[model samples]
Target chain A: MAESKKPDSSRRSERSRRAIYEAALALVGETGYARTTIEGIAARAGVGKQTIYRWWPSKAAVLLEAFLDVAEQAAQGEPLIPDTGDLEADLKLVMRATVDELNSPPYDAPARALAAESVVDPGLAAEFVGRLLEPQLQLYVHRLRSAQDAGHVRAGVDPRIALELLVGPLAHRWLLRTLPLTHAYADEVVEYALYGLAPRP
Target chain B: MAESKKPDSSRRSERSRRAIYEAALALVGETGYARTTIEGIAARAGVGKQTIYRWWPSKAAVLLEAFLDVAEQAAQGEPLIPDTGDLEADLKLVMRATVDELNSPPYDAPARALAAESVVDPGLAAEFVGRLLEPQLQLYVHRLRSAQDAGHVRAGVDPRIALELLVGPLAHRWLLRTLPLTHAYADEVVEYALYGLAPRP
Candidate 1:
């Protein structure tokens, strides 16, 4: 509210905000969550400590906001997956984008760090799941519900749990770093998940 | 090899071995993997540092062995899932055991700690997937293959990938602590994976 009143300083404030977000992401990636501090972020961003404090409450808040900013940027003003009326194709498009985003370095390092840290820190993990992840997942649920209405999906199957079949394998592979995640793999996941892994008699 | 030659001292060695395993698991659970050291484990175990060295090469090795011991003990001489020839029933039986084991405290804390660390450490994660996790996964593959042979599963489905559909969701939920892992949930995973989310013609 205070920032909007001073129109002249808005651009400079925006620049500082972006710098702080970038700085927080970089520092968290380099130092890991336990060691990354608000002071370090401030110094890296070339901003004063009070500037950081004026906006965010704690280091977790900064990192979470930084990640949220990165995610929003990744979306490029489109918050929801494109509903092309074809669930499989639409899913493939979004999953492909996800595969591409994960492949990119700008988001990978910080996202991976945050994910690793979240595993140990339950409070941060809850925030991450509730705020950052579950919203995206709910979008998938919406898409699946549309599919159910279209008779593409089995009506009895719960959209929420069914969605995990698509996501769980991808997430499992990503978190464990067990295998290479490719666009082809994403397509396969979409296919296998939607078409069924069993022999269709 | 060398220890087995001296059969006379085997009883005392067994006691120290059990104590060290317990100490390693406890310390890692309490302080996490990075802070855990051979000296600390030895001190906690009431054994000398040399004793740990004689048995395991590094902290990772100790934790790996400790986890393996816990897993083996959890099975209580029943290591492999029963090949009851009924694929669905067999999978449920095993997955239910997994749900119970994860919910129980004896192994939960240390296993969670190890999994958290493994996410950040690629080499250890690879070894974990290859040496420890894959062998167990391959057992699923074997069972799935038998199911395929019996015409219970679609022969075209890759048993390796199919197994992940069952294992991945459970692991994802367990790792994230997103929800209560129950026998019912495990049963659902087996059903959904086998039958899939698409309409069955």
Candidate 2:
């Protein structure tokens, strides 16, 4: 009977965790980050405030975890960019997927809310970079290293920096809303990063 | 006597405007955008709230114009990227200057505040891109066009899109705080954008 109770409690904990994540994302999306509160999240999730405080210390932590969960779900448990032996094709596929995600409503609002707050909050910015952005970027780093091994990428190129050439332009266009972020734009970014802008010598 | 009085009033108005710009910048820098208000700006500037409202519609407007004033001052009235006939050298110089400006305290704080707010605020983002970012980007467009004319850049490259390759990475680093933004980083971005990351065929 004690063993059965343990399993039931663990199952309930998992359900509560999922509910909290959903509530945090929806609340941040609807109200900006500055306005989102632990109370609001707890209420929306139909869990007690103590439930959130027991699990997370702050709103930023909750939002960061929520974003990470959403990103993981989007990647279907595989967060790495695919390597089809064609570096250019693989990058385009990943970039196009990024464009779609950025354009989607579910991801856009909450991500923007967190990103906005991070700009002014150095502590949150560091955590965001350390936990969310860096891990994803490392995936690109591994992909580029493989390309270098296969002679697809230049041997001297730093995969860390080279990946920026692909992702940076997309982030800029999306964040600034300077232009329409299209699949075509993503393809062009991949091509430009892979080929010389100067005429081939 | 009437003409002399007219000049005095105009001088007084100009002085008041400069004071307001300074106050707005300082306040926004000290407090995040959400906390900055017209009353705070007016008190700091030693003017009535009506003075600020008479010239600007809202706090966003006041902050935007203040940023523009600071940018113009930084450019010293010459806002165009220098055209030295060496495309790589010219780009590197401009990029390095940008890195310096982004690192400076006076520009960094308020700019971050505005950038943060713009991320969640679509209306302000549009105004920001339209009024500030696009005009500056056009300078890069003109320079890239000249490079194409001189056979320095491939004619097939679109100056507008190509310019993103230069500025985007720098901005990504600056906004995300993912890495140290240095002149060396700026030079490398120019090199990668001009030469490409893939090996020469």
In order of listing, the candidates' clash counts read: 0, 0
Would candidate 2 be rated incorrect, acceptable, medium or high by CAPRI criteria? Answer: high
Q: Indicate the residue-level lDDT of B47 in model 1.
A: 92
TM-scores of chain A in all candidate models: 0.94, 0.95
Report, for every candidate in turn, its global Cα lDDT versus the true structure: 0.85, 0.92
Q: Candidate 1, residues A1-201: lDDT per residue as tens digits?
A: 876677767878899999999999998877678889989999999999999999999898999999998899889898568887888889899988988888788887788788877777789889888888888889989989988999889988888888788778878888887778888888877777877656788
Expressed as tens digits, the lDDT of each residue in A1-201 for candidate 2 is 765667877989888999999999999999999899999999999999999999998888999999999999999976559988999989999999999999999999999988888888889999999999999999999999999999988888899999899889998998888999999999999988888688888
Measured by C-alpha RMSD in angstroms, how accurate is candidate 1? Answer: 2.8
Off by over 4 Å in 2: A1-6, B1-6
- Candidate whose TM-score is highest: 2
Candidate 2, residue B144: Cα displacement in angstroms equals 0.5
Worst 10 residues of 2 chain B by lDDT: B1-10
